[model samples]
Target: MEKLQSPARDIHPDTRNGLHPVTLLNRNNLTLLDTGTSAEQFLQQKISNNIAQGHQDAFYVADLGDIKQKHWRFMKELPRVKPFYAVKCNSTNEVLQMLATLGTGFDCASMGEIDMVLRMGVPAADIVYANPCKQVSHIKYAAAHGVCKMTFDCEAELFKIAAFHPKAEMILRIATDDRDAWCALSSKYGALVEQCEDLLKTAKNLNIQVIGVSFHTGSGCKNTHSFCKAIEDARKVFEIGKKLGYQMRLLDIGGGFSGNSEFRPTFEEFADVIRQSLNQYFPNNKEVEIISEPGRYYVESAFTVALNIITKKEVYEKGADGNSRRKFSYILNDGVYGTFLDFYLVKEKQKLKPLLGKDFATEQELFPSNLWGPTCTNVDKLVNEFYLPELETGDWVIFPNMGAYSISMSTTFNGFPQPKVYFVLSKGDE
Candidate 1:
């Protein structure tokens, strides 16, 4: 990975606070905001400058202020539910550091994630092993580190936890109505509602402590009723646990919050549904505490990618009516194997805007185009059948809202290197 660096030399008046001013630097060391340009315009200028400086391939811009804004919005809208930032989604050190400084908890799935959080000075109690299936070594590592809060969905997991970490606080994961979710996990995780009691009884028999219930309606869920219905089901399990002489004190509403703005259910809208559901199901309970595992909500919009167009080819093919049709295909430096797996994994079409090009004049014509990555395989295509301004070989494309699964999902396949990441902070960060 190669980073583009420039000498800092510009002072921009701080709109966030009256007392302090921020200095914005472009890739050419140009100061922003002083020229009366909006932030988006400054970003465009930065991208242009970096490409001119021969630093063009693919790079990620991580804005700390955007993360802070998401954190503020989450706290304001869903104050009752404490968020444990899901480590599996974009666990960049900068992101983890920001969340850690903000005093947020973490939901780790593997030993590496837990170790990363712990190395940041977070307490073991603030970490939860949310993956239902556990490796024996991972269980021992969690026990050795004093991170014992975990979730389970079956009897096998109970025995494994009892043998490895007998004192672990177990949360029963129940299946939810994930039919409407973009990436449903009910088939792979979460025990059925009918099996909840038997699972709890088995835990009791094994001397394992069952303390609460957890459920994920699925990733990027747009349905509001899923949460409400899931909460209702969790309440039923709570009653079952109470009848089993177990004290239930925690409710882990696993992640489903969407960060893609163009998609359904804004953060505020999802929070409203969750707020009403919590009020109805677990209202004003002093003994019970509610927490959520949100992965994309904090870092999704904070990231953007700028990629260099490597080549473009114009093609003529026969149409269905026996007429010849013309179209253009573009190959970029990065593709589905690097920072664009979501486009393949979730059918997520990233917002692509031309940043630098010769034919970008106001009256420039648009054409039917297909975008691809610089990989040998045909699966490296990024966009299919999108109308874009006619671009040349040296042009650039910017992808916004790419922080969620891009970095974490990137691979070194086809000998392609991951793009270098550049951090831009709106304010001072410790």
Candidate 2:
């Protein structure tokens, strides 16, 4: 491996504090404040997320210091809407407690998750067991704990719940599409319109209370029109339930809110769509409740990942014509074995920038760099190709928009400990 060299010009002024690369890249670029100021500052100093100044929260924040004290603190003091933090996104105790404080509920996928939320002092009523595929043990656990509200998409699951938990409250998971979804979730879960009618009939026969219709347009949903389509689907389901003597009391528009994309629908616009859908579908029903499950939209910008550069190497690649392309590789102390497994396994795109100290000056020279995590396996690479200022051994790097899937998908592969997490609150002194 050869060393990749940096250019000779200085892009930024020299400073005394250590300069992480990210700060130098966006010293004056215009970007939204997704993480809030307190979080941005805290992350700038502690993690590698290269957060810019003047950023504020758009959704919710979870404190990481006390791993057992998960809570969701809303950025805006909005009224009339409750956030059901999707537990699958990151169910650390710290995250859960943070949400609990914000009066948010849990959208659980399994019995273990439900129990975890219950142990955290969140009442069973505040939980929506949203997993469409319910194991017998999970159903039994819900029944035993007096958690009667859950989701089902198929007749088999409805029958299982009816036989074991006859009084369970149920929601039919309906499939919908968004023309602008990064990852649509309809293939794995949710029932089609035709299937929804049969599932509702089964629910009625089993004496289950069908309270609502839920739809997930999928993750990274950018178009508000997709939400509108889902709302229309929910209306259809509601009408079918009405004909069967089942009163639909709730509408759960499931998670798919985008946090990383530069293009996103305004919350006001999203809220208006939901409001209009409700007004158009159930004009006389003021008792019907509208619920939304948003995970990435709330927490993706709240946290940052800080990693330390352990070693540097240069690799030379030979082209077909015998030309050579040189690159620099920086091995960091953390990788897929720690809090970034999703980045590797799922090939998820992550934003990388340098965490520059105040006194650090930016080097004008550009170098193609590959970031490797500190795992023994050859597969622990974080970023294959990235442009950065000249970085040497012991330099620290930061990645932003890492709050959603990073930690939740981490593993102890190669035996590396997970990175420490901290939450920064902006409210006046507690």
Candidate 3:
């Protein structure tokens, strides 16, 4: 039998009283941390996102050493905007528990997610079955569980829901063209504006209560205009509903909030754009409730993935002019199989920083390097070409702005177990 390589061990390059790569990378330069504080200690001081103590190695720890539970940033500038977390982002018990306690409702896409939220002690009324295409079984489940609200984009879905769950409250998911956004939702769900009247008539005939309208502009939307256009489209739907004597009570501006540190829009700024548009469309409609499904916005900047640097090599590649260009490569124990599957497989851009240990020496030794996961496949590379301080095997790296879609999207592709999660808590609360 061939000998298998052991998972990469943590590298300690030198012996000196220094900081871990995790700490150094998060310092003022990276802005991942406000001060040059240890990960454990920084986890302790914050109040709103406080993590409880003592479960560092557990698969699920609400408070990992010093991490806070509420590190997620809400829309501070638009405090009036309430966020309904898209559950598909990260449905882990710890993540769900933290969000639930924060008093945020859930935006569930399936009966399973609805069940999960209900199990967490969330009221059925607090969930929005946001998936436009739902299975008959899911419709039955939601109806049986008293989760009356859901989304639909077509007459077929409305009929399906009415057949299986006659009393279901519903929302019409309108399709908007957001060619400028990173990931548009038109390919998957929502109905065209022309079909709104027919869909509403069908809903009325089937006795399925049509109470609201919803639309998803798409994920990673850089153009704020996409949101404005969606609101405009939703207004048309509201007007149609009013003509049919159906008073729309809810407006779910679906999830598409980006949190990649490089592309992040402040919650306040985003809320301002959304709210301003809504007011223009439905001014003084205090009887109607405005809601948003924000997945990445709330959780993206809250956590960091601490990975162990395993191996390093310097290589050169041919440039456009056939010149040899040197580049460094640093392999780490965790990869796409663990927390970064999206970036690894989809070539999604991610931010990386070094986590130097306390006994390390010579910060100047760190160099620009490519990071790879522990898989034997060549495709297992996490960052194809990234700059970093010179680092050896056993050193650690911290990937911040990693709290949103990454965790929920992780897979066990290479058979490696998922990394442990720990929450930090605020100081005075503890």
Candidate 4:
């Protein structure tokens, strides 16, 4: 119940803009511009105009206003569970600054992320070192930065923390049913429930304070029962800590919440499941504070990518029945080695559609085309087989729900330049 003091520092200058920075193009730059439609529409129009002007590069449109709406929804639906926006999801300075102003905390995996949040004027208490296994140097960094809350799943991590950050408050990360999680982290992180008591006992013996229990049901989890099971497991761990004379006041139901269009169980539906589980498990435990690390849920829907078609080719393929078929290959400016790494990491299929042209209605012939990235590697394929109207050179392809994982996981592989981000501000956002 005490107010945690933020370290004194100068406010981030960009925060004055109250949003992420973007190349705000006016009517002269993008004549098809109209603020009335959604950001996706604006991006599509912008990309189309750029292609006509001989611009063949990939870019992203981040709607800061839309991000604010997502934050608002989280506050409305899961009021009891405070969200520490997973910084790794989309650590754009604008996004981080915006979330910080909205009073959201951060879940940082590395010292660089923790440093970024701290330098942005966020309180140390608002940041959690959520990675269960950490380098000793990072532990020293967290300790030096006053980030006392951290997670550990093994005795070795405990010894490292106790040596480098003896005063740090620790959270035991237990494994969950991550089989149904999109990115199952239990294999790498989290201690077994049976081993949790021994971990807590080890912490007690080391004179280290075990203050909370944490578990991630994995990212993009499809099963709602996963939440119930994890929460129930956390309850058992809390009792273990209590019996050991430790005050386990924090419960970090680690991130696995999803917002992908392909992901089943909508955000609201997941929230319903989580809320019910929390009520059933921790209803009378008002003294305990509950928090979550939600990476994709906050940023996924706020991003749209506009990739230009670099080149295309048509090939005749013979079937086993002796029927010849026309197969089309379209190479894009961005691929798996770049901003679309999620395809390689999680096999997530991104939705792609061409810009609807004036002649699109008249030309109704569709072709089976494979989308590939502009890389030498053949594995840079995006869409395996998508039925769409024939696309010409310089045409634009629009991908939605790309705010999370895309930018953060992008690389400079094959010498392709990273896409420039353009922040689209809705009317009255200023």
Candidate 5:
């Protein structure tokens, strides 16, 4: 709480007038933008500097200014529901610190995440262990670190919590019909509506404190009515908790809010629906604190990844119509295993395409190409159907809106290192 009380957040970014520019922000790495500087300007300069310095490794450009605006907008839109930034989305220290400085809580899903936030001077009170399923050692780590607010969905987790951390404030996580979600979590986590009563009763019998109910509408949520339905189900669980003599005081509307550049409901649209649902169900419940776990909303668009093409191969084949079908395959320094895991996981008809880092002529002949990761496996292919201008080994490919679940799920399976990050603050945030 003390760490979150910083006065630095008082300088809300310009809303009416455009951002102020900064001077002389040409350092190689980790430089903040001062007066007269913006993220776009910083991004261009950094890429040029990196190329000039032969630093062709993939990198992440974090726009702290974007995160700050997102926080301001979140507070303005969903004033009633406090946001607990989900750490698993993007655990980069800068993003976490930015949210913490702006008075947002942390929704850590594991012991490592909790340890990361705790090390940042975030009070345990400001952290919610949002993961319903956790290792016992992780549970013990949380209890020892004074993180009391954790979510649980099954009866076994209640018993374990009662035995390991009896003082834990458990929040029931119920399942939602997230059929329309791109990454539906209902299959893995969340208790059914009918099981809510039994779970609450189990906690009561074990003398465990059940503070509230929680639910996730799933990641990349496309179901417009999912949150409303989950909130409605949470209300029923709240009533059950009360009947069972548990003083439920927390309602965790879990993360599912889209923050990608993809076409999903806007934050304001989702907020409107959620606010209306909250008003209808939990109106006047001042004792109950409403909070949401939004991970991608604050960081998705805030980060842009730059990848250097490692190799290029062009193939010319004859089609059935006897026309030459020319295609290209470009190998990248990182790919589905490193930064493009989200795009890989999301099996879409037309996934997001990458932007060419180097400028090409508008009428340049584009060839159908497939992007591949720098791995020795056939499964390392990235983009299936993509058209791009002729690119060489040193060419750069930029992926904007890669801030969510991108590098967090990356691995070094093939010994290909993850992209390094360079954080920037525009509009006088330096």
Candidate 6:
């Protein structure tokens, strides 16, 4: 294969320090703050501004600085692995631009995502078409765009790539024991470890270049043993490829790390295990390049969303003791079809509770409340039986860790607009 010649640039200088500083300019006003300012202060001021202006629609405030902190931490731990930000996680312009400027690679799964990344002037070399199963047209598009880095699991995909993008540097995605994962993905993707030999051998027969191996311990994986086992399995595949005259470089440990700190084996613990496993299995680290496709780790906590109660209804039911038991159901501008999708789609039951954005009377009674979305669907409930103080229409409810899978997965199911997003960077809050 010819040497890739994407216009490579130096990583932004801000990355060297603890505070990754970058001026954020977006549709929502950017609040550049001093080192003393905090994310709470930014949210407090923005929520106040929106309320004062009678803005009842739900919206988001993103602390771009938090993303920088995450990036700095990512490099600090597991220094050998490079991050290819999963564009599907939060593909907003502000996010794409900031990460691109920070000099990290991209992991795109579809044609639209590929176009979005490349249109921003990101080099094709800095992209990995990580989706193992792809459309024929999408493969042609990648070939036309010089995106040779991609992945495959089945033999059909290998034949398709050989006929379409023959120069593709393919990564064989192997299956892992993700039974304990929050969202188990092995059932859908990943070729089993026992199947890797046949896949690699078949790739060579098809004149397809199998350059490396990749595996995902599922998103939000719980077992550290699964990670270690997967890495060890990858080493076995590497040996098989070498014997088949294939240079098994590039090991992509797909994202399963949590968006809120760490998934199962805490951040520090997972990092220690991964680092140690890499040392033990692929100790000649200089020979193989390492990369990860992290979606939530970068943006999960960085964005805060505020929603207003558009309407409210209180019902009183006769309890077993013949007492009136009231349950309040309040509707907000956004819901399952809008932003709180995981609840409806995956039944994830996220621990994401709403924080009262405004002060309530100390003596106000708290009741079991049900949150409903503005959509016409009956299943658009944000949470079932949440406790909250009696709130009037227009009262603000804020939620953190709203960045991942919220914006990218939201749809205008009932023609309701997606929440507006504000990007800000505070000098102090890392």
Candidate lDDT scores, in order, read 0.79, 0.66, 0.66, 0.79, 0.81, 0.81
- Once fitted onto the true fold, the runs of candidate 3 whose alpha carbons sit more than 4 angstroms away are 1-76, 260-264, 316-326, 345-368, 427-430
Residue 130 C-alpha lDDT in model 1: 99
Per-residue lDDT of candidate 4, residues 1-430 (tens digit): 1111221111111211222234433211222222434464456466556655777778887877777777888888888989999999999877787788788999999999999888878999999999988999999999998999999999999999879999999999999998977788898989998999899988998899889999999888888888899999999999989999999899999886776656787778888988998998888658789999999988887887878778989978998999998878888999989888885777752343333322344336666788899989999988766766677776667676888888999999978988988776453242
Question: Tens digit of lDDT per residue, candidate 1, span 1-430?
Answer: 1111111112112333321122443222323222223334345555656655776667776776677777888899989988999999989877787787777899999899999889878899899899999999999999999998999999999999989999999999999999888788998999988999999999999999988999999988878889999999999999999999999999999986877676677878888989999999899768788999999888887787878888989989888999897778999999989888876877752344333322244445556788899989998887776766667787777777888888999998988999877665553222
Give candidate 2 misplaced runs (Cα > 4 Å). Answer: 1-37, 43-80, 178-180, 261-263, 266-269, 318-325, 345-363, 428-430
**Prediction 5 TM-score vs. true:** 0.90
Give the worst 10-residue stretch by lDDT in candidate 2.
21-30
Relative to the unseen true structure, what is the C-alpha lDDT of residue 341 in candidate 2, on a scale of 0 to 100? 67
| Positional deviation of residue 419's Cα in model 4 after best superposition, in angstroms | 0.5
lDDT of 3 by residue, 144-252 (tens): 9999879999888977887899888899999987665666678888898899999999888887789989988877666676778888888888889989989788888
- The collision pairs in model 1 are none
Worst 10 residues of 1 by lDDT: 1-10
Q: Give the per-residue Cα lDDT of candidate 5 at 394.
A: 86
Residue pairs with colliding backbones in model 5 are 21-35, 21-36, 21-37, 22-35, 22-36, 22-37
Better of 3 and 4 by TM-score: 4
Ranking by lDDT: 6, 5, 1, 4, 3, 2
Model 2's TM-score against the true structure: 0.80
Between candidates 1 and 5, which one is better according to TM-score? 5
Candidate 2, 165-264: lDDT as tens digits = 8888899998887545666678778888888777887777778899998888777766767777787888889889999999788888787665554536
TM-score of each: 0.88, 0.80, 0.79, 0.88, 0.90, 0.90
lDDT of 3: 0.66
What is the clash tally of candidate 4?
0
Instruction: List the candidates ranked by TM-score, beginning with the highest.
Output: 6, 5, 4, 1, 2, 3
